[model samples]
Target chain A: MTLRRRFVLVHILPIVLIGLVLFAPKARPGLRPCGALLAAAGVIELLFLAALARRKRAVEPATAPCDTVTLVWALLTGWELATSVLHLAHPVLVPAPENVFDTFREQPLVLLRNIASSLELLAIGFSIGLALAVLLGLFAGWIPRLRAFAYPIANVMAPIPAVVISPYLVSLMPSFRSASALVIVLGVFWPTFLGTINRVTSIEPQILDSARMLQPDNRTMIFSILLPYVLPGVISGLKVSMTTSLLMLNFAELMGATSGMGYYVQNSITYANYAHAVAGIIVIGVVVTVLNALITKFQKFAIRWH
Target chain B: MNRIECAHVTYSYEAHSRRETVLHDLSFTAADGEFLCIVGQSGCGKTTLLRLLAGLAFPNGGAVRVGGAPVTGPGTDRAIVFQNYTLFPWMSARKNVMFGIAQARKGLSKAETAALADEYLEKVDMLRAADKYPYQLSGGMRQRVALARSLAMDTGILLLDEPFGALDARIRGELQRLLETLCTGEKQKKTVIFVTHDIHEAVFLADRVLYMADGRIVRELPVDLPRPRADLCCADADRLCAARRELLGWFDRTETEVQV
Candidate 1:
């Protein structure tokens, strides 16, 4: 069979099987909601596959998404069979896919509030940290004495995990939110600062020669020439720094915070609400993926010159 | 009066705790509007000499003077076109040219700089690719943009370190002719220090050619050929041929000396 046919067979078949299993005579009652959710997911998958197939003639089929869909379908089928169909797993620990998906419909406002809280903290911490890192990095990289003084200190500090000190920071700071933001900033700042320093120092000699010929003042040289020269490197490094900051933020939230995605999951697990905890975990995954996608788009736009 | 003077300039590079001198008390002077070519084999310090004149680097001894002023650092009065990476990769061709113009003619309005940039790009026949970035351009086209940039600057002194050296034969000849036209046209001719290893190019474009080897200028040859010499078919073809032959002879002698 052709790749497209094979993708349909592997991807679409599992999704159909999942629907069948969901609608089949359940080992217990109250499965109609689960059946409805599975049917809706199957319809969405069908539409997506149709779109992919239509574009296949113009572009090669990306195997990753096809494989991802197949894996997701298989996991859902297995989870439904194990929890609701066969009753093979622990009753409270392993929740059915329906219960997890129900949380989206049942407690959407609460989930949204938690996401907003997490995003707000992330935005503030990430923006402040990245801005400070880039500005300070440019200055520290340009000046010899400052670079010499800070390079070694950053080297020493960059490797210390922000999570290790969050407890102390939380106790020291007046608010848990400030401690979380501080943790994220420290996590992102060192690497970005060091990367900027190295990038500025290693700018191509020919470019430096051309800029120097212009006889720009110190401020113009730093802002106009050096900043643009190091921008591509900075943007490429942003994804890593962002991921680190997110990790630090979540870890801090898990330690002590009244609101956040991490706190939501921690709160669910405290009451042994595995369904809510699993839903919260999935929410975190979706949020991180969406943020990463945005970062990728920004990178493409920023380095369009390349 | 001389526009640029390199007086007994010497320079060296330090590598692995050792100093290797590149220019040994080299001295030369170019009168205003003269097109001077420094021709030498590879590793003969032709580029080093050009850099000294450009004020991109300082000599360990003596000084490079432009218009009776000692060279300190790179200035707007002298514009240089290096062999590679002369244009900023992040900027379009038009922006690169405008950058130089803005530096040289400060206080000009944006529209004025843009117009001047277009004019020079037109002169070099690179107007169509004005919005293209450096990476989008071919090697020859990038060199054309670099040439347009220096030309647009309208600096009195143009230091070219084998600007066309990386191009193929056809493109190199075309650029050489373009450069010759621009340098000798109605506009005030810039004092150009054109460095090349090709003898034919030197004889074709330069008013005076300096042959250097082993950190010293071996000979100086002045070409009296008329402008627009009509390529190798013109009346001055024999003189051009003789100059090329003499330059080749110097190269052969240097090779024999090295073998011995």
Candidate 2:
């Protein structure tokens, strides 16, 4: 469909959401006061779509805004129909949108603290994991013996999911924090390390010859030439690594951690508060979106040559 | 003493578990301040010979020497330019040049490097595009930066492997003129070993042209044409015609005559 038609189709979302606010029956008792929240969500979604439609064309693809928002609207409408309006969903398992949105208003601190905790672990874990991979991968790739050793090792280790071993790692580590961080590290390290080593080995002969003609010493060759050459590959692979590690971090938190987005959901589920758990899921989605946006910007800056 | 010498150099590489020889016992020498061009058909090992000079590849047997000393490995004394991919894509044209200078000459401050980069960039008429990355620049523009980077290194010898081969006719002509001007217009002339498959280009640029075939020098011709080949290309018709005819004779395609 044309961008106009797709954008016009997006009006269904606010309509469905506003209909819930205005006409959703008091069919069930103990449902929260959800009029303001549902109305604000509908207005905000409309304003967001409007802003997206007006953004400069070069910033993103034209149909992305329309296609994605339409999908989100479709899902949300289906969800509201099943739980809030139709009253068909199980109350304890699938909370109404009214109850889910109310969880944000009731206890904002709990969610914020969990998000902060997740971000902290992600920052520390990702940096250590990626940095160590590139560092070791460089030497391992450049040296013959190390490359032979690393290539096979990485191949063997990379296919084994880090989640499969996280429970054991958690039990072995001294604390939950280290265990969770290790899980994130294990998730991120192998593929990136393998990628880095492969890129280093397969540098174009012409480029390599040009660099060799410069007669850089070993230090200059490795740090100055080889490192920069492999960097774009590493940066480009960063998104996949990031998403997976974040998944591992959350999974690790689900086991033994007291705080994190995963912990918030797990705790809410333990207490039978499906509303808070659903809110936590939405928060995780937001975090992933924001992180992806950041990595894209960094990719532009770091690999301009490509 | 020869400025550059390759004494019976042989080179081969293993591809798919098969060793293929590219150059076989090839031997040549170039004098100081001489412009020597090796002309041949594709896959005749012209680039391989040039790489041997640049010390990017070592001969399985025999040796390559520059300034009476054996070439053990690549040195700052000999800078090189390939047809393409010589300039690092991540760096801007200016930074690429700066990097060359930094590698060849140690302890130059960042400002000094920048100044030297701009100097060479201007010499190649690429100063405007100095801040642009290789991807942003056209094929010819990238060659210009590659040339600038090599020149900025201040190497005594320059090894070019069909540096203009990838460019179109117009840009190729422009760069040929630029390269000739840079070589002839400067004092303290550099010994250049250029490898190309273009007979006309070889005649225009070189004092001596070597026609290579079957992984060896098959024939040689000396060009007696005057300076500034761009003007000579139009003016000195007789000598230029005679020289290209001689090169064509070497290539065994006498019917294919090259115009000045």
Q: Score the docking of each candidate (DockQ).
A: 0.77, 0.80
Q: After superposition, how far is residue B207 of candidate 2 from its true place, in Å?
A: 0.4
Please, what are the lDDT tens digits per residue for candidate 1 over residues B181-242? 88876575889999999988998999999999988987999998888755556557988899
Best by lDDT: 2
Candidate 2: DockQ?
0.80
TM-score of chain A, every prediction, order shown? 0.92, 0.91
Q: What is the C-alpha lDDT profile of model 2 across A182-267, one tens digit per residue?
A: 88888888888898899999998899899999987878878888999999899989998899988998998898899999999999
Instruction: State the lDDT of candidate 1 residue by residue for A187-280, as single tens digits.
Output: 7788888888888888888888878887878897888788888888888888887877777787888877999998999999999989899989
Model 2: docking quality category: medium
Question: Per-residue error at B193 for model 2, in Å?
Answer: 0.4
Q: Assess every candidate by TM-score.
A: 0.95, 0.93
| Deviation of model 2 at A97, angstroms | 0.5
Tell me the spans in candidate 2 whose CA falls farther than 4 Å from its real position. A1-9, A43-47, A54-64, B14-19, B233-235, B253-260
Q: What are the per-residue Cα lDDT tens digits for candidate 2 across B3-22?
A: 99889888889999999988
